[model samples]
Every structure is written in structure tokens, then in C-alpha cells.
Target: MIIFGTSSSTIHPAKLDGGCCPFCKTKNQMWIQGYRKYFHVFWIPFFPLWKKIYSVCSHCKGVFEKKEFKDQELTTSFEYFENNKIKIPWYHFTGIILVLLLIMLISILPFLTK
Candidate 1:
């Protein structure tokens, strides 16, 4: 049986403002959102299979992808999070680290027999 490895979803708050909902025409109700889909083992993400950017309408509950945003500001604002806060973490390498430790232990085992 597979003891590890899974997929996870995360949502991040965006640092954007001054956007209106195109559907409800409500001002200051739109917000930028970041999404990621990644593979993980031992609860640590290995790598993100896909990344997505979106703008959601708070009042209308509308979801808009990058190209779906009708407002130019919303499209441009999505670029702000590209390298800011949405980057993958280095701790996602826990699985790799475990493998390396096992390799090192095997390599040193012969020396311990001396």
C-alpha cells in the first residue's frame, strides 16, 4: 500500500485593491487570489504541477482566471505575486533529504566494519 504522496490545494490572500466586480458592478469587491496544485510525500510538497492566478468577486462569488478578468488593472495586478509571496518553499525537499541520508548511511556502513 502507498503510505505517502498526495495532492494539496492552497489559497493565498492577494495584495490588490481598487477593483470592481464586472458581474454585480460592485466596487471594491474584487480580490486577487493565488492557487497551486502540487504533489507531496510525507506531507511535504515535491513540486507544483500547476500554478494559477485569479480574481474573485466577493459579492457575486464570481471566479475569473487570468485572461478572464475584464479589468486591465486586475490582470496587471496578478503579476505582482509572481515572485513575491507565491513561490515554492525549499522544505518541499524532505523526501529527497531522507533518500540522501539513507545513501550516506549505506556508504558509511563498510567503514564501520573496520
Candidate 2:
């Protein structure tokens, strides 16, 4: 049996300077957290699939998805996260890198003999 599935990790959270939470009407209390989702085998990440961002209202302790955020400032803040928080960790491609090295070594081994 092969163990494979998907998992997500939280990216650095970003704070909105002038945004207000639609739920609590709190200004500058809204923050967004990004999750990097990837397919994994035996807990080793293969490659990233997609990213999801959610908003948290610090005052009200409410967590909401992109569709739930109706405030304009929060909407633009979500866009900022979608565009900027996409730094892929090197470990996410460990399987690919290992496979590539193996292929290269296999191809070069025969050439090196006699």
C-alpha cells in the first residue's frame, strides 16, 4: 500500500493597514493567512497544487474565506496575498530533485565505464 495524500502549511500572515472587517467593523484588525497545499507521499511534499487564503478578524475572532469577505479593502488585501505570498519552499520539490539526480547518474554511469 502506498501512502499519498494532500496537506497544507501556513504561509506568513499579512496585516491590512486600512482594512475593516465586515463582521466586526473593526479597522486595521483584519489579517490574512495563506495556506500552501501540495500533494505528498509519506509526508514528503511532491509539488504544490494551489494556495488558499482566509481572513481573520482579530477583534471578533472570525475566520472567513475569500467569498465571505465583502469589504472592498479586505477584497484587495486578499488579492495582495494571492499575488505575493506564493514563495514555494525548496523541500516541496525534494522528490523531483531526487528523481532527476537518479536519472542523471544512471545515464552517466555507462559512459564513465571503459
Instruction: Summarize candidate 1's per-residue lDDT along 19-94 as a digit string, tens digits.
Output: 5666787877777776667777657666666767677788888887766667676656666655565776555556
Shift in Å, residue 112, candidate 2: 2.8
Shift of residue 49 alpha carbon in model 2, Å: 1.9
Candidate 1 — number of clashing residue pairs?
Answer: 0
lDDT at residue 52 of model 2 (Cα atoms): 76
Model 1 misses residue 53 by how many Å? 3.0
In candidate 2, the residue pairs with backbone N, CA or C atoms under 3 Å apart (3 or more residues apart, or in different chains) clash, namely none
Off by over 4 Å in 2: none
Give the Å error, residue 39, model 1.
2.0
Give lDDT tens digits, candidate 2, residues 1-114: 889999988887778666788888888898888778988988888888887778888899899887887788878877876677657878889778888999999999998995
Among all candidates shown, the one with the greatest lDDT: 2
